[model samples]
Target: MTNSLPEMAEIWQQTLNWQPSDHQQAQFQRLYHLILEGNRQLNLTRITDPQEFWEKHLWDSLRGIALKGEFITSLKEGASVIDIGTGAGFPGIPVTIIAPNCTITLMDSTRKKITFIETVLTELALTNAKTLVARAEEIGQQSKHRQAYDVALIRAVGTASVCAEYTLPLLKQGGLAIIYRGNWTEDETTGLENAVKQLGGVIEAIEKFTTPLSQSIRHCVYLRKVATTAVQFPRATGVPTQKPL
Candidate 1:
């Protein structure tokens, strides 16, 4: 049986004040097929059910960056974006399909996953996106990649502090990082504030929303880079997650 994702146009408009264009919708469908095929060999993702995949993987991924409809606008103006630890291309592929004007780099530590995403990009005919095989720690320090992105996206990667450390070092001044989380707490926010500050970033906003399909609580923490990060940032490999700022 071929699982088909729901084309909930009304829900997309109601929740995000946006709807996918015809080409984008078709691209999403093709992406679903590619991912399912890739899964057979690569263990791509656990979300195979169509509706569940639509809600959790596609919707949740976009929601992190869709603050009051700003994400769409930014992409329209051709922003540079990066997805750190983009397992199976979660938000990155969806964003690449929806925002054809923006350039997207999907970065992951695993060579096989990046290899799979490279296929996904080619199959989707996505010219504005690319794949990177490297850990966030190493990429954050590279002179070519450091402070190079206008937006950074991370989800299910690590603790908020570690996410901050990984993301902030790669953002240009005034760039934004969207950290996706399932549940959030004020205490966690307090801790994140200190961590972001140490990385030359500040908490711009934290939005809490419920999933339209499952009513699951979710949070998106927005961090803005206000100054240049110290060169010592991102530490060594595994340092961010082990010691976290």
Candidate 2:
């Protein structure tokens, strides 16, 4: 099953207007295998097929930043990034691979998953990334982590309000939070705007795009932090999911 993943260099340029370097391509291939090997011991991810993994995990992760390409590149070299609830390191690992200068924190509440990611890091020699095993609520209130990141990435976590509560608190003023979702609606957008307003952030943009290979609908919500988030946010463990904002 060597080279199970299709090399879609032209497709990437056509869709995202960018393609990975040769080394980045190799790293992506390595990451795929690492995740596959990890699944046997842990329930890291269910999308194991090469094509599925390429579209959902690898391509989809970078697609968010590709939408805000110029703005994301404006972030200083060595910018701090946190991937909250980064299960199996989707988006985080891909971001790390692409942005070699940025320092990425791959955080997940599950210890086994973090352990598996740690191995992936070592195997990939992904020195720019680090793994953290902690909940978003816990870190959002911590002195060292609160308002410490330039970018926060979250995917498939919870509701829009819950995502805002969990991510807005971790971003420095002027920082950006990119939330990935499958399906979105006008009502959801209204609610999300209110939630982020309460958290000292504004909805900068809500980009809807179809996936390159499958043509699946996806949305990338960009929240820009304008002021300090209230201290009550992230609101105790289970509170964000249970009560949201």
Candidate 3:
């Protein structure tokens, strides 16, 4: 098995029109090692092979936050970001490494996972990133975290509507939520539309793309928070998944 992530600079430039600096490259490589090590004690992730790790975990994570040629401007402008259910800190950690200006909070209900991420952040010396041990439903009701972020990211966490419920209440009006998925359909879009609208968000755009290496289908649903979410949101822990929107 390959044990090292390839420094695919050309792939980065060709696909996202963005390239990591030498320091960022080193950080990415280090991140790969750390996740592999952490996987032994925790069921962190199954994508342990280096090449697969780079494409699925690193590139795919960053792709969700970018457009054709540029990253979301808010990220460059020191946006406050929250990654709901950040199990292994894919996009949040990578986003923190590349866009040091943004402040990212990696939240997960599992304490062990958050503890592992805390170690990763410390070892990486990522001052801009922090870890949170809490459920999205509970955090959305907390005054300190509610509507405090400019952008919210969620991947492999739950359904699109569940992701919206977990992320929307934690964002300020006009904040953006990126929902990452392996596949999407028109029926899913219709369900998501109603769910988001009720959560005070609008379906801004949906992007469909394939990974550079695996060529697997992927979708990113971008929702813009247009109004204040109702206080009842997040509807108690596990309720979002059980009852959904």
Which predicted model would earn the best lDDT?
Answer: 3
Residues 1-245 of candidate 3 have per-residue lDDT tens digits of 34768999999999888899999998998899899899999999999888899999999999999965579899888999999889988778999998888899999999999999999999899999988999998989999999999999999988899999999999999999999999999999999999998999999999999999999999999999999999999799889999986
Q: Candidate 1, residues 1-245: lDDT per residue as tens digits?
A: 37777898998988888889888888888899998999999998999988989999999988887986546466778999999999999899999988888999999999999999999899889999988999999989999899999999999989999999999999999999999999999999999999999999999999999999989999999999999999999899988888876
- What's the lDDT for residue 182 in model 1? 95
How many clashing pairs does model 2 include?
A: 0
Higher-ranked by TM-score: 1 or 2: 1
What lDDT score is found at residue 149 in candidate 1? 94
What ranges in model 1 sit over 4 Å off? Answer: 69-72
User: Each candidate's TM vs. the true structure?
Assistant: 0.97, 0.96, 0.98
Error of 2 at 113 (Å): 0.3
RMSD of each: 1.1, 1.4, 1.3
Each candidate's number of clashing pairs is: 0, 0, 0
Residue 153 CA displacement from its true place in model 3, Å: 0.3
Better of 1 and 2 by lDDT: 1
Candidate 1 Cα RMSD after full superposition onto the native fold (Å) = 1.1
Estimate every model's Cα lDDT from 0 to 1.
0.91, 0.89, 0.92
| Ranking of all predicted structures according to TM-score, beginning with the best and ending with the worst | 3, 1, 2
How far residue 174's Cα lies from its native spot in candidate 1, in Å, is: 0.4
Provide the lDDT at 126 for model 2: 91
